[model samples]
Target: MSDSSQLPYRPCAGVMLVNQAGKVFVGQRIDSTLDAWQMPQGGIDDGEDAETAALREIGEETGIDPSLVRIVARARHELFYDLPSDLIGKVWKGRYRGQRQHWFLARFTGTDDDVKIDTDHPEFRAWKWAEPSELPAMIVPFKRKLYEDVIAEFAPWLESIA
Candidate 1:
């Protein structure tokens, strides 16, 4: 019963980074053994804006220069998903039930060679570009619904419109 979890969902930001080919970036978390992959996401630091958090998380998790991503879309509203009961008290220092995230869709303006996963505080062990349709199935089961919502919300980015 962490004080934070008792409050509500953790404030977070997420990114759907799409390349010119319309493929979204996916990463295999270094901390997971379940083959759970995810888009870049993380807590929105105190006093930081959601968009800023999204960009920072992208750089920290994937080593992509924030300058190389052009904003395409922002989620119309925040989206939430709860961690499984078994995980609620075991993850994030038991400080969050899950995340309530503000998602951003950005176009990767750089080439594939510009992606360097060896970030300062690396969160991913591996990464790749995959069709947006595959996102929901690629993430952890608990977050599938969240991914689906994200994919739907950023359908335009998936079409390479940005």
Candidate 2:
């Protein structure tokens, strides 16, 4: 196998969507058997900027309209996480070692009724609002540190809402 270090990190965007209650959105991945939950995130398409990709991903995954969310703050810098060795060749066609993600914090202006996880191509089987501090523990092991960094980067904004 080619060295994972030699592989490129996929460019992606992530969202930390928090409601008025300061709880963040998390979803159980439809494709994962593990009890892993994650915020809305996906690859950045050609010519699309990170912030735009973040919004688009949120709409695609959660069926939340862009108008229903207010962009709060973006992470100071991009964060990265590596895929576990066993998953390296099984995901993303083996082209990427993991993801380098630009994350955004957005406030959900609509109620829970606004969230619909049954999009045409749904990524999540279930979704919920979670406490910010619980983020790292809820995600896949490989992504725990990345979630921690996201929570840290948005700490001030998260605290202000709480």
Candidate 3:
């Protein structure tokens, strides 16, 4: 990840998918990839809206239809991490510079069987549900604060869901 502070904030959206068991969905990045587990997120495309991007990212990453999920909250956070030196060249192909993510919370209403890893884009290799507090250790350090904001905002809902 690029140093988020150095890069500047770009508009983005993330989705936290929580199940009835109180476990939130997390995806293990592809091997030697970003080297972190994360909720679904992506940059907002020009002419595309934030909610649209959030729904799109969730579907692309987890194969879950946005319609099957309910939006519980929308949280905003700015994160800065050094761009992995190797990927400095392949940035999002535009003027993004860095990611300014708007995170969303959702609960899965559909069966889990539909989730699959896409070999072409290959964002995540493995996935599992875990307690929200367990996330910081598994996420990229630069992005941990965003998860913190998310968890803090959702802690009460998490209890309610439980």
Q: Taking the tens digit of each residue's C-alpha lDDT, what string does model 2 give over 1-162?
A: 889999999999999999989999999999989999999999999999999999999999999999998888989899999999999989999999999999999999999999999999999999999999999999988899999999989998997864
RMSD of 3: 3.4
lDDT leader: 2
Q: Rate the local accuracy (lDDT) of all candidates.
A: 0.88, 0.95, 0.75
All candidates: CA RMSD (Å):
2.0, 0.7, 3.4
Indicate the residue-level lDDT of 131 in model 1.
87
* Model 2 poorest ten-residue lDDT run: 153-162
For candidate 2, list the clashing residue pairs, or say none. Answer: none
Provide backbone clash counts, one per model. 0, 0, 12
- Candidate 1 residue pairs that clash: none
Model 3 scores a C-alpha lDDT of: 0.75
| Model 1, position 53: C-alpha lDDT score | 96
Q: How well does each candidate superpose onto the true structure, as a TM-score?
A: 0.93, 0.98, 0.81
Residue range 1-162, candidate 1, lDDT tens digits = 444447479999999998888888999999889887899999999999999999999999888899998888999999999998878778887777889999999989998888889887778999998888898889989899999999889876566553
For candidate 3, write residues 96-145 as lDDT tens digits. 45566777778887777867767448789898888989988889876676
Give the poorly placed runs of model 2, Cα more than 4 Å off. none
What's the C-alpha lDDT at position 33 in model 1? 94
Query: lDDT score, residue 100, model 1?
Result: 98
Q: Looking at model 3, report the run of 10 residues with the lowest lDDT sum.
A: 76-85
* Winner by TM-score: 2
